[model samples]
Target: MFKDLYDVIVVGGGHAGSEAAAAAANLGSKTLLVTMSLQNIAQMSCNPAMGGIAKGQIVREIDALGGYSGIVSDNTAIQFKMLNKSKGPAMWSPRVQSDRMRFAEEWRLMLEGTPNLDFYQEMVKGLIIENGKVLGIRTSLGLEIRSKTVILTNGTFLNGLIHIGEKQFGGGRAGESAAYGITEDLVQAGFEAGRMKTGTPPRVDGRSLDYSKMNEEKGDDVPSKFSYLDSTKPLVHQRSCHMSYTSLEVHNILREGFDRSPMFNGRIKSLGPRYCPSIEDKINRFADKERHQLFVEPEGWKTCEVYVNGFSTSLPEDIQFKALRSVAGFENVKFFRPGYAIEYDYFPPTQLRHTLETKLVEGLYFAGQINGTTGYEEAASQGLMAGINAHLKINEKDPFILKRDEAYIGVLIDDLITKGTEEPYRMFTSRAEYRTLLRQDNADFRLTPMSHAIGLASEKRLRRMEVKKTASAQMVNFFRETSVTHQEANVVLAEKETALITQSDKMFKVFSRPQIDMQDMMKFEKVKEYIATHDLDTEILEQAEVQIKYSGYIDKERNNADKLHRLEDVKIPEDFDYDKIKSLSYEAKEKFKKIRPVTISQASRISGVSPSDISVLLIFMGR
Candidate 1:
């Protein structure tokens, strides 16, 4: 019951594997997605949510590239919000509260609908490598499935260790068993693997909660969907989450369990996410704070289960219950399940190329938790790229790698493959140098053309993008060419508390003023008539506004990126012996040899490789 060959075989059917399988198959690769359980494909292992901060940008990027994450998220979302709306456009992010069951089911349905994609339920135990190239994979049942490329997205399943207080079990998730054979084989093949831990909070029964004691957190008045393709429409009715806090009594009860806590007792040695710490770690770290906020989020519209955000822990069940009961609004609450931490193996991402293929093993790739990243969005984006590159490799086409200036996905891969990470890495707005140009409002603007050229973005999507581009240009042109009289602008200006303009001004110039809004400028009747005739979306208008307002900053960053491009273009030969460069320090040579950075720009980002070492390399190269 197995094929001898496949173009690509994706192991694990989580976020990364699902994306990888879909992308490769959609690109014409005869792909096989093998997982332990088909029903858990694209499962939200930790939480029932998607996107936040920089992660949202990644989802949009995936969508622009014709990936299914955005569409699945849109179809499954129960509530939606635009985070950081009051901030700059670069910081604006779209997040969704999704139905976990629907999210996974949607992914499975999307994959099933995709051509060239085949599904199998099995655990790949070893790789069949020939001459340092991945030839195929061998499963636990002694069957070998041949493939030109193998993408390993074994998220938190490889030798997974779950800790509940002092008790430990071998499982990827709460009840899911750990994967075996691959980790030992990879280690035997000289791949370095380390342990990293991540935990999820308890699930509570919504019916057991006292909603009157908590503050209601509603979705945005005008909710937005994730996909730009309009594959799914937004819901008419949205669900609401609640906000509650842990009191001093809760902290005291939690403290009672500290002695037996796995994290505190040194039972767990792996590092966890710093930004999303467990409640135990938070209380220990922020001792001065009397309370910590816990968000009561619904698991799905059809279920009464709620995920207790900001309440992650690995304490004993009794302690968990007691501590939870001490929190406000949870005094009479009951839990569906207790939280636990799982430690799993992750190979440092530096071992992979920008295309996500392993440098040591051709046609072999890794993504998601296997690569040491934490979030669902990060895993999904990496999966999509890995799938694309795997397909390209099988087709004998050039690898599709995005540059830092191109998309947030590019920045994520570049950073991971270049610098590597010791902890469970998560995306942040501060990581991207060209954030102003990478605004979420214009992800399609930046990536749709490339996706269309590559045959991922459909013709219909491209046509829609073209219309948006044309309409936005028309709006910009109207603003640049149209002039408004002082009398027409004075009324709006006075309303906004600005001094009246004595003469005519270009609409662009007027709109550029910090206090002026496009809606307010519509009072001139000319602006309103132009907008009504064009019938543009708010996104296009917002993009034009950001372009005009932040033109200076955007240009400056572009120039900076241009200057850095020269360094990026300077290739560092893989076999170039850093030890031969006598001017380089011992530490720099050791670091360079280990990382083997592809370019001088990447070499500069290495932790121990200093500016002086870069200068020495440049001088030695006769630059």
Candidate 2:
């Protein structure tokens, strides 16, 4: 049944694979998406939600770069939130609780409508490798498929083993069958593979829970969306999520199953997510604490399925039920399925280049859990970059890489390749030093141009971004050029508990006051008149305000970024002889030779490579 060779073949249908397939196809590469089952495409395997903290920033970045995650999330959301709203703009991230079914369906619709993509339902059992390059994939039924490039986003599926108390099974997820042969083949082919574990909370019946005893959580009154483009509508109404607490009674019951617990009984040796630990782990780790919070999240608008957030476990069914029922709202809860942990194979990302292309095999790329990344946003972002780079690679073009100052996506890929992850890696706002410049509010402003240049972002998106930039610039200019009188400023400044202006001064100065904000400054008749005359929206108004207020910090960070970028420009040949430099430390020499950092900046960031090593390299290259 094989016909012609495809340009790019994506071997998974999870978040990473979906984005990868969409990106390659959108860039004019004829793509094929192979999955074990079509029904589970883009399935929210864990919680039925998208984005939080730094992860929300990543989704926005993905949206800015012509990826479908944001649009999909917007269309599927039952509730929306702007996390850290009281904090600085950089920490404010948009998150949404999605309809579990709708999220997957929207993704399916998006992929089907995409021009150059084709789908196949089959488990990829092995890769068709020749020499040092990937040719395509071999399916479970023994059919071979050919492609110019292969992206393995085989999230938690390669030889996956599931553990639940004393029971164990072979499965990729709760119900899906585990994929085999691929990991074995890759390992035999010189790739180093290790097992990583992750677990999900039991899906409980919503109708069985008691909301009256729990703290009701609602969405923000004003809902914001993910897509910078106007494709998705703003949410007007929203669903409710509830919060409940686990008591000492719950812990006692959970402890009853300790001996049979797979996590503590040595049935699972791999590390689970540190930030999101299982209920059993939490109780054990913080034994002095009286309670732990449990978020009761809905699975879908219509379905009775509910996700027991903060209750991930792999204990026996009886113990799980007993412990959950002891919690406030879960007193009557019943499981759709008990929670379990899955251990799967991953190749340490240090084996890959910054482009996500494997150094061991050309035309081969890895993303998602296969690279040890943990979240949907993290996986999807990596997939988007890998897909873009893969397409660019086949066409003899230089790879597209986002710098650390440019996007959170850049920080993620760089950290993975340069540092290498022993445990599942997660993204946090603290991870990016240039957080001030990479705020979620300005993702489109930062990445749309680059995406457009790569042929992924549309002309319409580019125009939209330009309009925002132009309007914001005009707004900033008006603030700088216009003068506000002491009388005009005092009314606003006095209310904010700040000093009154001595005389008429530029609006920029008034805006720069710590207590005053753009909204406060807008109270002046002249400032209000300028905004009304210009017809600027909140987005433009806010961007201009932040720029004027934090100009000093922004400029300082930008200067530092520029200085570091100088080292980034110092190119080091991939085949450079680090061992020949006897002046370098033995550890530095080994690390430099292993990483083969492409630039002096990258070499400096390597774990064992020190400043003196960089100086030695600088002196060597000086010749």
Candidate 3:
């Protein structure tokens, strides 16, 4: 049935594939998304939530760049929260609990409505590569479809093996069939393949749980959204999640099943995410701990199925039931489905360029779990970049690469390609050195203009970003230019229990103090008048407040980033021979040759490359 050649062919329809297909098609490419099951497009295979800590920043960045994840997340949200409100702006993150079924539906609908995008149901078995370049894909039915560029976002379906205690099965997810051939094909084609494991918790019937025994966690009084665009709004009503704990009794019951556990029995040897370990692994690792926390989260607004967060496991079903029964709130819990761990094939991301294209195969790219990343947000961001670069490369346009100071997406890709993750990689705010400059609040300001220039972000999105930028700047300037009297400042200062000012000063001066915030400055008539007259919203006000309060720290980070940019500007010749550098350390030489970093800044970030080694390289480069 396939007649005409396409620009991009995306294999797999999970978070990464969905974004990649959307981005490629939205950039004017004729894109086709081929998956094992079209109904499962963009499924939340693990959790029914998006955005957390650094991940929230990534979702916002995706939205700014015209990807549909943020918009879909906002549309399907059931609960919303701004994490780390008491922390610095850089630490502040927006997260949401979603209606699981709706989340996937929203994504599918968005992709269907997108121009130049098409969907097909099929398993891609192998790529049609010729002379080191990909031409298209060969389906399991032996149909050859042609495309200029191909993106692989196979997620965990690649030769997937699911383990539940001693019993095992060949399924990608609970009922989904495993995908084969592609891994073998790639491995035979000179790609290195590794196995990585990840797990999800059991889903219990919410009606059977006694919520009176647990503590309720509510959403924020005023919820915020993930998308910077005005297309989606924050939740007006929300659902409350419940918190429970696992006791020593519960731990003992779990211990009885250790001999049968796939994790403890070494039935699954691949490493799982370190930060998100299974409940069995947790008790085994932290034996001294009396108990562990577990959150009882509803799967959707109307469904009785509840996800048992922090209780991920691959223990036998009987053990899961017995142990969970001992928990405070789950005494009568009935299982919707038991948790299991899955191991799948992944390629070392060091083989990928910054644009996410494979270094060994021209016009071929890998994203999501195929690149060893764990979270949906991480996968989606990589997909977005891969799609954009694939379109650009085919069109003979410049590739888009976000700098470390620009977005969390940059740190994610750079870390993978440079350091290479042995375990499933996840993003964190602490991972980025210039976190102060890459805050979640200003992602639109940081990325929208660039995306617009690339023909990805729409003109309407660009205008909204520009309006926010101008309004926030005006607000910051208003604080700097307007002065407050001692009487007025003392009223606010005394209320906050801070030292009263003896004389009038710029509102910015008083607001810069640790105790003062935008609200305090808004207490001034002039500040309030400026906001009202300009009709500034909460987003604009928050942006201006962060700029005003954290101006010193922001400037310092900006200068540090600028200093690093000098090294970034020092490009290394692609064909430069690292073996000839006799003075360089053996480890440094190997890393330099393996990663083949395009810039000195990237070279310095490699794990084994020391300061002395950098000095040697700089001297050799005639710096």
Candidate 4:
């Protein structure tokens, strides 16, 4: 039994669906999360980890927006690492290896505790639509539930087909039944759908691996967490992941099974993620390479299950076993399960607006794999936005849209709805043009206020953000104003092996040098006193250090972002006629009509829309 009419109904319970439900419920909407199995809520369907590269920034942004992903990740993390520490602050990302079971459990608990959310278990076979508008959902048992808006976060489950070598089966994932009907319904309803493929690595028994033959990858000495909140703590005792390699012999063994592979044999036609390719694909594509690296990661703190990273494949099980046995540490590996590739139906993101609402169907939204995004972080971010916007739509409020410079989430959505990815869209540092301003450390500074204004981020969150912001600004000011004597500066500079100044200079100038860092500055009595007197935490100090050190780069990026914001401000009316623009190229016109980008900046980012096309539009608009 379900409510007569719910505010929002979320189909599926993966990262995307979970975030969507949480966001809608937290925003005071009566939301229902319907999944095939409630037990697998927010499952880490691929890797048992969260955040990597630009994905980390997304988790931080989710946390900053009062979403539960970051908090859930921190609560379940068995190991913590801040990746790209050696790189600039802009490149730094926080990552975690999670206890798979706990990650899902924590998410369910968080969702259950939320006030306006309800849960149901069922397969949503079709949408309740009338006159090009979705009203609710129809379950497999012919049960109809009415809702004001429906969010389909059906990740990899729309007519899903799993491929394992020559053997193909209908399934969403390992041991899960495939969902059907919805794709056909939507297709018949005039939405264009395409197939996309993604794969997972095998799970093996950790006891079978030989750690002595591999390199141990430990967590950070002082591990950091994903959540900005004090709700969870950084991991203390941590598990170590081991790294091994695939030798020429291993590749030779794998190549023998290539004929049987779904990928090579043309049994699977859909495109998979190019970056995260299967082992067989990797070895075949890079034949010149003698060996490929493999990460042997533990699945949980207590479980003997291990995940064989970089070994995703859909070769014959015997072939998988034989090839993996030749690796450095997996000489006698025991399989928990073999890896397989799954192909699923996805609607072209071009059919969706910036709010993730379908252009074809009013009050209907799509997120996660349905939108052609690959990673959990990307899906979750989209889900959160979709949920927020869906609720706003029903309540007659302006939709919340993040801009390109403001967040990586903004860049992700903009790229999806604008470019329309053919392959699975993954977030990367290179994707965001204004990454310097979108650093992971300052996500709260960038997004908390906006989320707070929207009534999602709590007053406690706002207060915390305000306090951190004030403290960091004061610390940066101290660095700018305080001068260290040459005797003090040279000692610190000499220790860091940097050129010592002959005279006293502002600490900010000295600290701005690449060789100098916060540790060195903290050695100064004045700096240490300021930090102690202000009762500054690591977060505040780190934020201040980045601001002080990268102020010039930050200012330049902000200036660039501001200049571009003019184009973003130039809003195009919803019914703007692209067909009448005689000077526009055929491809540009087609893209404009399809994507229907709301702003000139969004229009400029469309793949085939050249700068000249933008100039023509600007002139036409009398800019």
Q: Write the per-residue lDDT of candidate 3 for residues 1-623, one digit (tens) a residue.
A: 88999999999999999999999999999999999999999999887899988899999999999999999999999999899999999999899999999999999999999999988898889999889999999999999999999999999999999998899999889999999999998887789999999999999999999999999999999999999889899899999988999999999999999999999888999999999999999999999999999988887889988999999999999999999999997888899999999999999999999999999999999999999999999999999999999999999998999999999999999999999999999999999999999999999999999999999999999999999999999888888898899999999999999999899999989999999888888888888888899999999999998998999999999999999999999999999998889999999999999899999999999999999998899999999
Q: Which lDDT tens digits does candidate 2 get at residues 45-101?
A: 999999999999999999999999999999999999999978888899889999999
Lowest lDDT block of 10, candidate 4: 227-236
TM-scores, each model vs. reference? 0.98, 0.99, 0.99, 0.99
Question: Which residue window of length 10 is worst by lDDT in model 3?
Answer: 518-527
- For residue 22, model 1's alpha carbon misses the true position, in angstroms, by 0.4
Q: Write the residue-wise lDDT of candidate 1 on 475-541 in tens digits.
A: 8788889999988888888899987899999988888887887778778788778777877677787
Per-residue error for 424 in candidate 4, Å, reads: 0.7
On TM-score, the stronger of 1 and 3 is 3
1-623 in candidate 4: lDDT tens per residue? 76579999999999999999999999999999999999999998888999999999999999999999999999899899999999999999999999999999999999999999989899989988899999999999999999999999999999999998889999989999989999988998899999999999889999998999999999999999888888789888999998999999999999999999999999999999999999999998998999988998888889999999999999988999999999988889999999999999999999999999999999999999999999999999999999999999989999999999999999999899999999999999999999999999999999999999989999999999999999899888888898999999999888888898999899889999988889989999998898889888999989998998899999999999999988999999899998888999999999899888899989999998999999999889888
Candidate 1 deviant stretches above 4 angstroms = none
TM-score of 4: 0.99
Off by over 4 Å in 2: none
Give me the runs in candidate 3 sitting further than 4 Å from their true place.
none
Q: Which of the predicted structures, 1 or 2, would earn the higher lDDT when compared with the native?
A: 2
C-alpha local distance difference test of each model = 0.90, 0.92, 0.94, 0.93
